[model samples]
Target: MRLAIGLAAAAWAVIGSAASAQDYRPTFHPDQLKGPPAGAFNEVLVLGSPHLSDLPDSFRAEQLQPLLTRLEAWRPTAVAVENLSGLQCDFMRRYPSRYAESVEAFCYDPSAAGRALGMDVPTANAEVERLLEAWPKAPTAADRRRLAALFLAAGEPGSASVQWLRLPAAERVAGDSLTAEMAAALDRRMTRKNEVDLVAAVLAARLGHERLWAVDDHTADSATPPDEEEAQAKAIMAAWDNPYVQARKDADQRLYADLEHPDGVLNIYRDYNTPDTQMVVYRSDFGATHVEPSPQAFGRRYLGYWETRNLRMVANMRDVLGRYPGTRMLTIVGASHKGYYEAYLNQMHDVRLVSSDEVLR
Candidate 1:
């Protein structure tokens, strides 16, 4: 009788444990804690933007003025851009087999500027900080030119553009630390339609900021195995064929089509940041990958990369906020990264997520 009773009790315990496991929801929600009890709260605005380089030829650089005016009104104290730091790129340079293609493709080769200035990436990066630390109250055009050249040597053309734009039209010519070749290079950068140049750097310069922060990270990215390339591409593409992907594309097309409207471009940014956009986005991309049935589990591996990349990006953002509390940071990143950025950032105790709709308006 005793043996039979113990067995029945054990069966009930097993059943109860399984039931709880299936129904379990985490009770501790850090996102619910919206504020720090003391001191200034960190205000973060995550702006989702399409790759401006991909926009059609008809899109004018001046078209961004309206959007820029609105963001300027918000007066973000600092702006963080979606470009990898010179230091991170420098670190990745050591591992050629893993990062050769990524470095060649994504990272700017600052060697020429470095050679001209007699500064490697590290020394130039250090000089950038030292100069900024003792930055004068009223800097001359020469001061700006010197910093711009240092920024180029540091492999941060975006920040260099901020300094370039700050200069008077006449003072934009090569002199001081910025060599003639580098000046022409920056002239090219100033004309590029990409948001890093036309948007972030432009706005930062307009706001009187000396430099823009580079917070993008790519430590998670690696060279795809030659054999797995086809499998990986097929799995991700297959996942993207869902209705949500089509709907997202259609919605974006509708928004982009109306760029003639006063707020057409801004409206697209607002739409990308809505709360309802999260699951739709996930289903269209990462969630679909999660459900993909591949023997190689290529989908899961892709998902891991995506999550890890976003997590690291969020950490970089958080690190900035931690260093400088009470900052109104404008983080301009790619649209697909918006949902993940918000979800991860919300968990921080001091960070208060500002609605993009409010700022874009």
Candidate 2:
């Protein structure tokens, strides 16, 4: 709302006519946005988090408590996590062949896991609270598997896998409907993936939220032919070997190191929300300008697909906000997508972004 085209024309004159006549540059001064309209401001905090579980050996679940505690204080009306919708997970479970990859990734087995837990979706999420409350000091293998079944029942197979992984191989046997195949499904889901949203789920439950929103969209990234995909990746990587990119990589390493300390988690969140971090996302990652035209065009196509996915995810979040006006919502997503999500969500008439720095403090 702060954008003044008339003022922008006057400002353009300062750049000098030597700057290409065809070049388009519209400056964005976000401070100019008139604060949200009267009444309760609908606040949104788009949190960019690394996949914590994927971190090195030093990163433990307990280390996340302080970060979650800080977030819990924000008192979000709703929490949105990066995951497929429960309906989609159900369809994947029923028709595995059609959605084999997704079904495998989610480790959803409605017939077995669903029956074992005895609930679905909103009703099923209650088990999450029960598991948290009744978590044993030194849980037996049976206890672990039971929790795993409960997570699957709650439509959180990723978290279920984390629980199942804690059991010893010999003790990870079939129990009731939890057969070896089901156990393997759980194991497969945990493979090479982090349960980032599990943190979001815990925070939501602590705040008395009924359920978390599944706003991630996979339908936008269509399959490019394998050869074309490989070539595109090669070209993009070649362009990415610059000083700006290297500096970001160095900073990322430092951030990853900070995840080890309990207090460091808050610092990590604060750093991620800074304008410097968000600007790099555009200048180096999405807005890098030196690739040849052909490769650049190919890269642009990939960026388009990425933007489409974020747009759909935002639309899903908007759906939740529409149902409950004046709600404060928190979206927990991968750090790389943070800029895109904020950019699209800021365009919405009613939504206003809450400063993550203030929230961390």
Candidate 3:
């Protein structure tokens, strides 16, 4: 009788355990059962570049061709540059003085291009279409300059760069209504701050793309008071005193030495987008710990501004990129922004990253 009773209890316990197991439900919903279909995604290549043009001593214009060639083979459908969008253009046009600091720093010449082309942005763009439609099979240097001037007038520097490239090296010298400053600007496209951006524009025009996407955001950035700003900037730089900073400095020294090599330039970008390098950016630059008597209080504020700027910029990219599925896109941004962009963009359902390695190779 005792044995039978024990067996019955064991059976009851098993039955109760089974019932509980059956009643259990998962927290995950059916809607998240699978990711979007593989075909419904855009392949993004985030190329993180240093402001080489800013470091004039370390830049070489001739070294850019190999890099440009590799990027061109990727055949990106859209190229997003780190420039303020048309909205910012409209806002700045309305109140140029408000953004005088940016204008002065960036050397923005919106009207220069327009003035050179002899038409406004819209009219110049229409002329671009017209010229391209009846593009000459064997155009002369003058013809190319005319197209370039029109591209410049339309606020299309990238396309302008392309037209400049079409001219023979001898013809690229001067004259043809192209000013000295404008010539320098076009040459700078291959050397410095706008190098990748200009390359994108060139490739886009070559591929018959109408315009490059301007996706930079700055409205979220807050300016520090001029009097206190210098001290605060120093404090921020002081917080970044670590081996990593030294390591990067060492790397940059090497880069400067190899400025003449295209592979050398390309390597700088490759290493910059690496996961380890990005983590360092977060820890050393964006995530430095601060105490109450924080020397880096302004630094923290700057971090907030940087994040907000990137988030808004990513939103702008999505607005343009999400519409055209399966299109390969390249975002040429400051190296500091690469990690943040990847983190935010990876979460979107329809977007996927193409390893820069694949594209660069």
Instruction: Provide C-alpha RMSD values for all models, in order.
Output: 3.0, 9.5, 10.4
What clash pairs does model 3 have? 53-192, 113-153
lDDT of 2 at 306: 76
Q: Is candidate 1 or candidate 2 better by lDDT?
A: 1
Best-first order by TM-score: 1, 3, 2
lDDT of 3 by residue, 293-323 (tens): 3554776677777889899988988887766
Model 3 regions lying over 4 Å from their true place: 1-40, 54-59, 96-98, 115-151, 166-194, 201-210, 258-262, 289-296
> Model 1: per-residue lDDT, tens digit, 1-361?
9999999999999999999999999998888987554777899999988888877676888788888998999999999999988888999999998988878877988889899899999999999999999999999999999999999999998999999999998999999978899999999998998989988999998899998888888888888899989988888899889999999988878888887787777777778777777678888999999988989998888899899999999899899888888989999998889999988999988899899978776
lDDT of each: 0.89, 0.70, 0.71
| Deviation (Å) of 338 in candidate 1 | 0.6
lDDT of residue 217 for candidate 1: 83
TM-score of 1: 0.92
lDDT accuracy of residue 246 in candidate 1: 92
Model 3 lowest lDDT segment of ten: 287-296
Q: Once model 3 is optimally superposed onto the true structure by TM-score, how far is the C-alpha of residue 116 displaced, in angstroms? A: 5.9
Clashes of each: 0, 0, 2
